[model samples]
Target chain A: MDFLRRLFGGKDNSSSSAQEAKKRLQIVLINDRTDISPQLLENLRAEMIAVLTKYMDIDEPRIEMDRGHDESAVALIANIPVLRIKRGAGGTLEDRFEDNPDDRSEGKFSPRGEPPRNQNIKSRRRK
Target chain B: MGARVIVITSGKGGVGKTTSTANIAVSLAKAGKRVVAVDTDIGLRNLDMVMGLESRVVYNFIDVIEKNCKLNQALVRDKRVENLYLLPAAQTRTKDAVSPTQMSELCDQLRPDFDFVLLDCPAGIEGGFKNAAAGADEALVVTTPEVPAVRDADRIIGMLESMGKSPIRLVINRFRAMMVQNNEMLSQEDILDVLSIKLIGIVPEDDSVIKATNRGEPLTFTQNSPAALAYANIAARILGENVPLLQLDSYHSKGFVASLKKMLGF
Candidate 1:
């Protein structure tokens, strides 16, 4: 048991030392290729989320900015939700008329009708 | 017999291409063979510095090509070793100063006088690199254990293959055995697995290397330095001597019994 402990312990120490060297090299190369630092990547991530929020309803938790294999490029991936009018909500008087069975004979909902409230909420969330 | 021209190149910068060229050139020269090491980096030449002949360069490679001086005028003889010469690159001129035809012609001229002509190529796959590799009969790809360097080396190998060059050898430099033992650094096996080329030499990171370079001396001059010894062994290997790869870990590590006592509660 003593012999085994000594042998394995030596192996473990050497293995860890090698690991540290590898980590240092990987980090140094990543920083060398990309002018952006780790802190900058975090700041960029925050700013990216803010900009993406202005256009559409996004699942904030799902948004990610990843470094490329070359370390010279950045990738922005976001899940944006498209906004559309709700079937029934507080809208223009035309929407009430459109909802009426009698108005069914006419074409789709009138342009004056308010867009869906849920969509309005989504857009307002962006603000 | 005509000398074989081999260019050591890497697409990525700081991957020890110049160092490999210098060491290999010194190794070949030590074997009593006439060898010439050419620095093709032009504006950013480091081969002369690595070979400890930077100050001795009176006429640059550009002078030879432009007919400003004779080839012998540009060649700098090493005082430490006989039959070893350095053809330095011009610090004032850029890569565009030399063409592939001129480089090929230059190598052809040197072939009759020397047993080996090693070209120290510059970083990047540009005009300078093309010029350095144009007339080479073979190539030595130098790369670190890192992924990016390995990738760049792979691209260089591909380019050499496209140029119909064969029997290219791979030299893995700045290897840390401790890191490899810890599973942190890429092993020689890993690099060979990716490159799939004949292994020529594996050089460990030695502090003596920096010290030797700082003094403008190649490591091969110092018998006490392991790095120098490694270079000597590589030179022997190049001369068809089967020298075993230096096991750095085993040399540095304490005995197994001592390590075992430390592991136990004793």
Candidate 2:
């Protein structure tokens, strides 16, 4: 109900009803389409944040995670805005920047070993 | 080599599955195609009444399924339109009375005789739905522009896809154009995006439909009415005609509310 209320901007007008219904349907159908419950999705997001935080400072509140579908398959799309990498937290700066092709091939989200079609990790560099 | 058995179904109740079935059947029949609308609702039969053949229903679908009556004997020929018939469902029997195999057999029997065999499916995704959809080669999923209806429709579409039913088209029934313009109702695009199926019809909310249903007549019997034209368009599309979608009257909001909507980027 909180999401529904937020969807309509706390207005009870007829104009807002459609928006509310659309949002409610889109949210509810994610489970049916992806076979992942919202609770489970939330848990996954939380785990992702926890893991990513170890090597990078991500803007958790601004993280957008949802199931996106293309002609081929449904994919777990995450647009996590990275504030900066934790250079001193885990390893050397050069080690943290190391991008292994093997690691990239093993997708973080794909449970069936199929890499996600799109995994956008936007770096929000703050000056 | 036979009629394409297309099931007109909606998982939710009272979303115009029966209405769409009646109108589309009538339209197809009027277009010189042999069409039969079978009420697969069993105990909740309304297709016969909608087609104005309730009094002439001597036999029902269950009778044919149980071998109590021949398929031809159970078909109620519509006197109003040539090549149109109604296979009424039994009011006394529950949905359990007709098994999926029996329904498929019934469809096969009607296939060679008609150009299109339309099964009016009952609500809910239960045994009744399975029985109705068992014989279907294609599907017409009906839903209103509401949350619950769209959700159930998505579920039905999923089931139909899993069953390998191809060319599954959507019919968004009882659409209020003005409400959609005012952002009071979900738009056609919103629904199609969610359902992710090809759209065949968008029936506008019309009083004529209620009047026709109450009189035991299909709205398609009337000429050029909004809902009638919509149903006729659906029929034409089914026959592989290149008819464009019906254009409903558009509305523009005025004054303070309009400014508010503009401010909200609606």
Candidate 3:
């Protein structure tokens, strides 16, 4: 019966009202806990795109920003689709990048330890 | 030790604050502890009706605060349960009738005379809520297993925490076990996870509660009802007793098993 239900895409674990309510509440509480409004998030996304567009040609429409909370901390995560890196668009950062050798060592440019910075933006808000 | 003043509050109305207050007060008084249940819902008071002492309320707490009557004169002693008293709210007055300082002083006056002071707070996070919570050392926030109720409960819990109320606990009322089993309703664990408070009790969805309410008798007066047993366990827990939770699932298992056996023709 379980196998048949799964194959037919019938009512399963994820379809319960309890699960739906839990998901909705988890989202609502993330906002409630952080006191961050959807408008604020939208503005933050706009500002973030403005900052990122100067260095790279990003797919602005596909950009996404969200807040997440877990056991130890709340975080702001962003996903920006980069079309191409604009070389020599800003000369000052290029000059600093050439001068600072320690910024490239062991991927210390990103505070996130293991994951490379190219994939996403993760900034811890609170611990 | 002095009395522990606990305010029973839920930001949303009709989640069984009066019922829990009445039942827990009766349970505590029946255990030979001096207990008083103060109805802080000034304009729309219902604790007197739930406790079946509406006819005995000659004076209310406002009368005591206003110097119209003495404190003991305003307290209506429960005839059904000894050592239980009710400081009923005035039906004609507004929530602004009782200030926080007056409520706290009333609590101080009742503390030395009783072992438990249970303030039945009104709905909403307004003046009535602040007035009721002002006197409480601890709190028991009541909520049903619904989204709005849980959300309001979270708001109340946050306000109570900001007020420096210690040992705030939860009372999840009208919990439908069959609905929870069928994944149609939120479980107590789910509510506790969202509210993040220590659970003091979970009262099952029992029809006897309504019958008792309409008849002006609290469920704790009965011996074996599911809600009665749950309220008794809650009262015991308030007194620092380590009683286990009442098996709410067992309240419906008999009917469930009988139906299953009938369907199987066993």
Candidate 4:
């Protein structure tokens, strides 16, 4: 298993077996707490990342499974970093700054349907 | 008006549910409250043995429910502790012999007479677990700070909550503080974090506990072991006492461990 992990570039969870058990347990418990499978969660994360990547420069997207309780419903938690937007051709951040200086929306990553999104498209003339 | 039937359960076997039931019952009765500890494991009954009331169990819990004997007739009084009783399970019969509703009704019938009624639940989330959990208004989920145990505890806690059982508290059994401190075992905080339940108490892994069980005595007998003190604290907390949690590592376990085992005749 160690050889396989090293071969596959898999990071070891922990050295101590007890802490390993705890780490494994936390993951297993989260899975057991919800009906959703880890594979499905991974897929969800991937799909969401793909959707977000198309609109903005997202860095270090992470999905965390936080259990509020054993009895309560499971909640999905995600954190995505938006560096900047992928604008139209010749719509680099520098060009946008030159055309509309002090455009707060320029080079900023904004969620779809938000105010900054329209402002971003207006100055860049991107769809 | 009636006593609260709190079922002591662990989804996995050999995690010390019966032991917890016996010690907690003894602690409560010693504190001057009327207590009855029922062994709901049916075929594999051991609570009677743990309470040292095995010989006195003339009529089992099934006998009372089936009308073979009166409820009081089947209840075996503890020899050492006053106001403490044991309702032994029928070792010869299977869990299928008793139904969930029947167990619920039995607890309901015994409620008004005692200050607290405790059920020693069997392992697994099957029929026996359902029957044991049926009558209880509260639950005490027992688990060791291990992977398999915590996983089962999580499932059991989920089931109990879905069943509408209120105030489910966790009791971490057989904890080894040194192992946890060295990161070779899961810490109490880690277990609680994963399980996400209110921690009632933590019983340290003590050598005296094994001796106590072998002698058919509850660990709380000598009050010498950290486990014994832990059980007593759990009982006190159950009574709404403002007892602080025991710091296991600081219990002077170094030299105290040797002296306690010797004094306990282990």
Candidate that would win on DockQ: 4
- Tens digit of lDDT per residue, candidate 4, span B1-266? 78988999989999999999999999999899999999999899999888777878899989989999999999988778789999999999999998999999999989989999999999999999999999999999999988889989988998998898989999999887667766688888788777778999988777877888789899776776778888999999999998977554444465766564344333
| Model 4 lDDT, full chain set | 0.81
TM-score of each: 0.65, 0.71, 0.73, 0.71
Candidate 1 residue pairs that clash: A6-B260, A15-B182, A18-B178, A18-B179, A85-A116, A86-A116
Q: What is the lDDT of residue B201 in candidate 4?
A: 95
Worst 10 residues of 3 chain B by lDDT: B257-266
User: What lDDT score goes with residue B122 in model 2?
Assistant: 96
Per-residue lDDT, model 2, residue A42, is: 87
What TM-score does candidate 3 reach? 0.73
True contacts kept of each: 0.27, 0.73, 0.39, 0.85
Tens-digit lDDT string for candidate 2 (B66-144): 7889989999999888999999999998888878998999899999989999999999999999999999999999999
User: DockQ, per-model, please?
Assistant: 0.11, 0.30, 0.25, 0.33
**What interface RMSD does each of the candidate structures achieve?**
10.5, 7.7, 3.5, 10.4
**Candidate 2: share of reference interface contacts reproduced:** 0.73
Task: List per-candidate RMSD values in Å.
Answer: 13.0, 10.6, 8.3, 11.3
Residues B13-130, model 1: lDDT tens digits: 9978887778778878878999999999989988888887878889998899899999999999998988999999999998898789999999999999999999999899989899
Off by over 4 Å in 4: A1-14, A36-127, B248-266
- The candidate, 1 or 2, that scores higher on lDDT is 2
What are the runs in model 2 whose C-alpha is more than 4 Å off?
A: A1-15, A36-127, B247-266
lDDT of 3 by residue, B1-266 (tens): 78999999999999999999999999999999999999999989899898888989999999999999999999999888789999999999999887999999999999999999999999999999999999999999999999889888878888898899999999999987777877888888788787788999988788889999899999898846878988999999998999977554544556766564233222
Question: Which of 1 and 4 is the better model by TM-score?
Answer: 4
